[model samples]
Target: MEVVALVSGGKDSCMSMLEWGNDTMGTDELDSFMFQTVGHTVLQSYAQCMGLPLFRHTIRGKALNQDLHYAKTQEDEVESLYVLLKEVKKRFPNVQGVASGAILSDYQRFRVENVCERLGLVSLAYLWQRDQKELLQEMTEVPIDAVLIKVAALGLDPYKHLGKSITALRPLLFRLSDEYGCHPCGEGGEYETLTLDCPLFRYKIVLDETEVVIHSDDQFAQVGYFQIAKHHLEPKADYDASLVSGGEGIVYDVWKELPDELPQCTEAEVAVDAASTTHGELQAAEPLDISLSHGAQAKCRGGEHRRVAAGPTLCRHKG
Candidate 1:
C-alpha cells in the first residue's frame, strides 16, 4: 500500500518513517506530507536527505498560539494538514495510507486520524503505545544521528544541549525522565530534534552555521530553537543499499531483548577503559578495528569509531 509520511524533521517523525519502511507493504518509495508550521522550513533538507517527494502547505491561521490547549482549538492546523494530504493524493493517485509518528499524543493522533477518515486513508501510527525510553534507545542503536534543535523543558540546559547529538544526550534524558517526569523521547514538547543522518538518507546533512534563539529563560523552564544559517547534503559513498532494497535495515529490530536492569559501571571503569586504548595506533591506521567483546567489534568510518556494548550501551570516541 502506498502511504504518505507526515514529517516535521523531528526524531519521532523521521523515526516513524524508518519504522514504516520496515513493514512488508512499505518501501522507501513513499510520499511525504509536512505542515509548514513554525519549524517546517528546515524539513526541506531532511526530505532531500531521504530522497522522497515532499508535499508542503503553510498553515494559513496562526501557526501556534501563545497558549495551546487540547480539543478543536488546533482544528485549523489540522485542516492545513488535510489540504496537504489531498494534494499528495492528487499527485500519487494510489496513496492509501497516512503514516504518523504519534508516540503518546492523543491530540495529534486523533486529529490526523480524523482527517484520514474523511479522505479514506488509513492512519498508520507504528510508534504508538511504545515505551518512550526504549524507543529513544532504539533510535540511537540505529544510524539516526539526530541533534536537539529546540528545547522547552525544565531540566534541559539550552546552552549545553543545543546542537548536541541525541546519542550524547541519553544520560541527561534518562535523568530527566527519572527525576522530573520528562518524556525521554521529548513527546510532550520537552524538546525537538533534527535528524542529520539516518539509514534512510541518500546523503548526510552537515550544518554549516546556526544561530541560537532563546525565546524564554528562567529558573523553571528554558525555551529556545536553533536557526540554521547554512547547511548542505554530503554524498554517502558507502550508502547501504540493503537498507532500502527490501532487506532489514539497522533499525529493523525492536529491542525486545533489552535487560530489565542494565549493568551498572563506575566512571573510574569507563575512564580506565578509555585510557587503555592505544591512541597512537588508532591515529595511524586508516580503518581501525577495536574489539569491545567476544562478538562486538568497533569499526572506524570516516575517522570515527562507535563501540556498542552488549545491551544497548554505546561508547563513542574520535580518532
Candidate 2:
C-alpha cells in the first residue's frame, strides 16, 4: 500500500521503511514520505540521498514554542504535528496508511492515532516496546549511518554524539542503560539522531558545514554540534571528496598497522555488561590489569603496554 511514513531519521523510522522490502523484484510495497519538523536541511540531504519524494512543513508559532520548551506530553507536541500530517494526507489522496517511528511512548502513539482517525489514515508503528538492547544490536547489523544530532541527557558527551557511528556507540549505550538511568536508545529524549546514509536513501549525505556548541560550567565538559550545510548530491562519475571519508575508490590497507601476536595470559573476553557504563559512557577509564607475583602488566587489545610491576608480567594477551 502507498503510505506516508513520518520519519524522524531514527532507527524505528528507518527500519519501518525497510519493512517494505519484498521477496521478489517489482513487488515492493509502500511509498515513503518523510517530514522534517526542525531540521529541514538534514531531511533534504536525506531525501536527495534516498531519492524519496518528501513533503516539508515549516514548524513555527505554537509548535516551535512547545518544542523550545521541551514539552513533556504528546498533547502539546502533536498539536503541530497533527496539522502537518493533515496537509500531507491531502497531498497523497491514495495513501492508505501513515507510518511513524514511535516506540514506547503512549503519548506519541495516541497522538498519531488521533491524527490518522481524522484523516482516515491507518497508523503503522512497527516498533513499540521492543527490547532496546536487541533493537540496537539489530541496527548495527543493518546498513545505515546513524549519527547523533542532539544530546541533552546526563553522561553523554555531546562531542561523542557528533560524528560517532551507531555501531561504535552500541556497547556504550548498553552500559548507560545499565549503570545510569538514561534510556538505552535515547527513547526517552536522552538524545536525538539523524541517519546520513541508508538503504532507504538513494544518495549519501555529506556534511560540509558544521559547528560545535560548547557548554562550559564547573560541573560539565561537553560539546554539541549541528550541520549548517552539506554537499548537494548530483549525478557524477566521481564521488565528492567532502562526502566520502578517505575519498572514493581509495583503498584502505587494514594490515598496514596490524600486529602479528598479542602478549597475553591468553584469550580476551568482553563482558558486554550494560552496567559498566551509563548514558553510553564506560564507567571505568582505567584498563584491566593482569597482576603477577613480581609486577603488574597492563596491555591494550592492540599490544600497547605499561608495566606496573617489575618481574615477568605477561600481558592479558601477546601481540
Candidate 3:
C-alpha cells in the first residue's frame, strides 16, 4: 500500500516511518505529510533528509484549547491534517493509508483515525500498544539520533539535556521512569524530541548552534526548550558508519536474551540489610574508612591494615 506518513520532525514520527518502511518494503511507496504546527517547517528538513516527497499544510486558527478531559477539543488540528491529506491524495492518488506515530496517546490516535475515516484512508499506527520500555530500547538499538527539543516535566533538566541524543539519555530516562513515574518514551507529554538521523535518512542533520529557551524554573522542576540557531544536513558518507552504529548489536543481544520473568528483590530483604547496622555501629565503621585519594588501607577482620593500590575501588567493610 502506498501511504503518507504524518511527520512532526520528532523521534516517534521518524521511528514510525523507519518501521513502516521496514514492514512495507517492496510492497509500498512511502511519502510524507506534516502540519506546520508550533515548530514551523523544521520537519521539512527531516523529510528532505529521508529523501521522501512531503506534503505540508499550515494550520491557521487559535491554538486548540486543551480541555480537562481528552475529547475532540483538538478537532481543528485534525481538520488541518484532513485538508493536508486531501491535497496529498490529489498528488498521490494511490495513497491508501496514513501512517501515524501514536504510541500511547488515544487523543492523537483517535483524531487521526477519525480524519482517515472521513477521507477513506486507513490509519497505520505501527507504534501503538507496544511496550514503552521495549520501544525505547529498540529506538536506541536502531541507533535513531533523536534529541530532546522541549521538556516540561519533573526530574528532567532541559538545560543539561536539551539537544542530547536519546541514546545518551536512555539511562537517565529509565531512572526517571523507575523513580518518578516518568513515561519511558515521553508518552505523557513529559518531553518532546526531534530526529536528527535515522536509517531512513539519506543525510544526517547537524546542529551548528542552538538557543535554550526557558519557560519556567522552580526548586522542584525546570521547563525549557531548544531553539535551532543553525543547522544543516551533512552527507552520510562523510562520517564513519561504524561509530554512528553505536551499540546496535549489544542492544539486540541484550534484548533477545532478556528473560520473561525479571528478578525481583523484596522490600523485606532491603529492610533487613538496613537493620543489620545501627546508627552508632555505622558511625564506628566510618572511622575505618580508607582514603580514596591515596592508596587505601583495607581493614581485615583481624584489625590489620592491608595496603591496596587503587585507580577505582569499591570498599565494603563489615564490623
lDDT of each: 0.53, 0.45, 0.52
Overall local distance difference test of candidate 1:
0.53
Best by TM-score: 1
Tens digits of per-residue lDDT for model 2 on 1-319? 4555666555667765554331100001111011222123454344344434444433212222212123324323233344545544454455656556556655455556766766776665655666888777777786667877655556777665666777778788788899986677777655556676655444556666675554332244242434445545544344343322221211112112223222211222211112222223211111112100000111123332233222112122121
Tell me the spans in candidate 2 whose CA falls farther than 4 Å from its real position.
22-39, 63-79, 215-227, 232-319
- Summing lDDT over every window of 10 consecutive residues in candidate 3, give the lowest-scoring window: 286-295
Candidate order by lDDT, highest to lowest? 1, 3, 2
Model 1 misses residue 101 by how many Å? 0.7
Q: Pick the candidate with the highest lDDT.
A: 1
Measure candidate 3: CA RMSD: 23.2
Candidates 1 and 3 compared: the better one by lDDT is 1
Task: For residues 94-151, write the lDDT of model 1, one tens digit per residue.
Answer: 7777666667765456666767777887776767767988889999997688898777
